[model samples]
Target: MRPMMSPPLLSPSPCSLLRFLRLCHAPRRRNPTAAPPTPYTFRRRPLLLLPVAMSSSASITAPNSVVADPSALARKVAAIRAAGPSKLQVIADFDGTLTRYWYDGARGQSSHGLLRQGNEEYDAKREALYEHYHPIEICPDIPLPEKAKLMEEWWEKTHGLLIEGGLTYEAIKKSVSDAAIAFRDGVVELFEYLEERDIPVLVFSAGLADIIEEVFRQKLHRSFKNIKVVSNRMVFNEEGRLVAFKGKTIHVLNKNEHALDMAAPVHDSLGDPNGSIDDYSLVKKRTNVLLLGDHIGDLGMSDGLNYENRIAVGFLNANIEKSLKDYSKAFDIVYLNDAPMRGVVELVSELCP
Candidate 1:
């Protein structure tokens, strides 16, 4: 059974999480030109720091930058084109957003999923955690406060299970390679565009670091130049043994603090009144964003951006019939069982003036 909530926890209820998530993913800050002149800076993000990285540059591997159709994405594209990758940033959720939610036309393994399947001991424990928490995770009817409590328990238990699995850094690498997670459609093109333009892409996920990198390495033909994965990373010692995870537990709901911690210095350095904006302001005068996510909780993926205009596209990978309305409401555009950024491809093409 899931444990009840205790004090000192973060994450909102399912509805609240959805509501705020819907609000947050839309890129809250607009009006980029109003800010005073400031130097644009870019920094290599440290694991502990958050939301501190932003940049502008694009280097395309393939010539597939612009998508077909000019009507649908025209306005957004114009905004992005005008904003010119400078005032824009990309923040993505890994498991379902960037990677395929399922595989072989079925649900694929996640970092946690693979961890559970790593050995026999994890099998029963995984089932228990799933039975106890997965239902609550998807139940929008539940209140945020109550859900937060459940999530805390779920994460704690899951972490314990992973630690108990007796995994080493080498094991993580092996698991990740064996899992062979595929990137969602258009994800490759998207990654390429961001890198070519030097626009920063922050991957904030509940997945592990090793797996995230593995997925990227497997998906992209070229190396990742402008991307940073802010998901949980394991600590390995000299002997390459896994010691512990780095930083506070980042459950699905507790991203704001993580966002702040990462973005604080950047936000402060840029002289933003609300604290800092890292080296490059994620949402600057040309502040526009193209956000992609999967879960209701994912809407907060870009909780730090002060966007002038943000276009969000969600991948409704499962239970679409039941949650379609809520998904549509939560995301500006919702793609049902579609690959990552497929809608984005269509959306980018349609961004007219």
Candidate 2:
């Protein structure tokens, strides 16, 4: 069970809060040719030596939670608060980070897992694949290069099975509707907050893009303009049946390389008059990022972006005792088990509100 919230932390000073509000309300400059400005750049700085207060509601008493360095965490919080939402970009993993790993003592289905349900034959084959590949995917003992090769092979075999099983767009919708797939607590609110503020959110996943879209459409009931999904998109035939996957496959480890193209729209919307596709320049202008994910590999989600401040919040949903150390190294702040996204929501609120 989740623990109760502690008392409220010391609020930001009125002056600092007002400054943040001004930044949030600052209008975007769309005229690129209006001024001859200096070239953009970003530098990583150590956390500030300022006094930091943990949000009363966000303070976790759970034994599984891990914050490797409280000073660094405070610095991230300060950096985010200082930059405000207008200058922020969020890149997140979909499967376990956004969705609950376990619900009501039963394992919840990921986008890919949802398609494997309700069919005995498919379930049997899926289980077999999991038994063969899942260990390699998660085994810390295996080297990443080897694991990457195995993961690609696993995805190839699974995609083949999905095609043989006659997976369709309609079938995906039905599966998501019938399966016990649910977003973690506070995810809906989090989406709403980002959407209302017009902050760009990219859901970068190795899961099926079609399934992810259906889940959002069916569950969230809105086509959020601010939220973009980049993953393995299924190519359908003339008759709307799954035929092949479009583009190069994006497995867990290679997400950073794939991110630039997937995040093009975000860069484009920043009003680059040259119509240039330089993701680096666009991202550098944004300068502050909030990254969220579930696995250690996910820490590379923002690999190419030049960001002034980045706060990686990781959800350690499985193997808590063993993985906490690694997760601590990968994420600035880590939440354990099935803990709701309250901490994330609170952090975002502090920046955007």
Candidate 3:
């Protein structure tokens, strides 16, 4: 029974209109008194916006309505998801990161070990380092700095023996085929996923490059597009006989510098769109990193990068209980005696998916 309201008044001014329509026949210019066009609000529709952000220049927190706990890691995953595909990067060590750490309740094999020729000989010099420095490597009583020094000694001695023994291309190839190495479960999946997402995954290693590339190409079935390897490649003669290492030999302790120096250019090539990079530049920088390694010495594998959010996962093979605490403090995640990389694969998938 309410009385009808009177008709609303039509304003003479065009400024008050919700949406103003300009006629094709009308032409106006240089009206100094005219106001600017309505401010573009850029308002988001209810159905259009997605909440995926790792960090922002502007941040004002709101109370959570959903009870799902947002742990720091979960929030990181969310931010990466929002960042979508481009902002993520992975840096991993080859031997222990991708290759299995242990199998069938036995000490696992290294990638190089997979190429181990049945003629695995006992070199006195190499054996000496193994005997002397191997203890220091696993000595829980020793500090990391001390262990690092011993590791250098160990790696140097091992490489020195190879240099002295005149390791040949034929010998190395024969060794590789005879080796009993295998990839950790889900490693191929992890690599493929990164490739699928257009994320860069750099394998920085102290191992042999030719062997790793062979294994990757043969097993993973993807040419190294998403993958970049920085390692000690072999130098071959015109006839393809191995002469020596292509560059300065890579070792466990000195891997960081080599990794940065080698991978910097590749990162650069991937970072930009112009495609001018050629003849090998190693100066590309990345913002975010998911670093993986199996050795305690592997922590520095991805060092020297200007990284933003870095998540390091260490695969623990020997001395799990003792190494767990140290590895946990040193790495974001530690998989102790884990046969495969279920945890890492899961994390990457969640962050990137």
Which candidate comes out best when scored by TM-score?
Answer: 2
- Candidate 3 stretches greater than 4 Å from native: 1-70, 112-125, 217-222, 239-241, 246-248, 257-285
lDDT of 2 by residue, 1-353 (tens): 12123233345566655553343233222211112212111132232111111223343222134556755555556666766777887888988889877755577788887784346797789779988887787777788888889999888888888887777677787888887777776787887788778677878888887788888877766555566677887878988888888777777776763444543332233333444222333544666778999888887777766566778988877665466667778787776655566567767887667
By TM-score, how accurate is candidate 2?
A: 0.75
* Pairs of colliding residues, candidate 2: none
lDDT of every predicted structure (CA atoms): 0.54, 0.67, 0.54
Q: Model 1, stretches more than 4 Å misplaced?
A: 1-78, 116-119, 219-221, 260-286, 349-353
Whole-model alpha-carbon lDDT for candidate 1: 0.54
- Model 3, poorest ten-residue lDDT window? 60-69
Q: What global local distance difference test value does model 3 have?
A: 0.54
> Could you give candidate 1's per-residue lDDT for residues 80-150 as a string of tens digits?
55545566676677776777665664567776776533577776786788888988887878887788778
Q: How many clashes (backbone N, Cα, C below 3 Å) per candidate?
A: 35, 0, 16
lDDT of 2 at 172: 80
lDDT minimum window of 10 residues, candidate 2 = 33-42
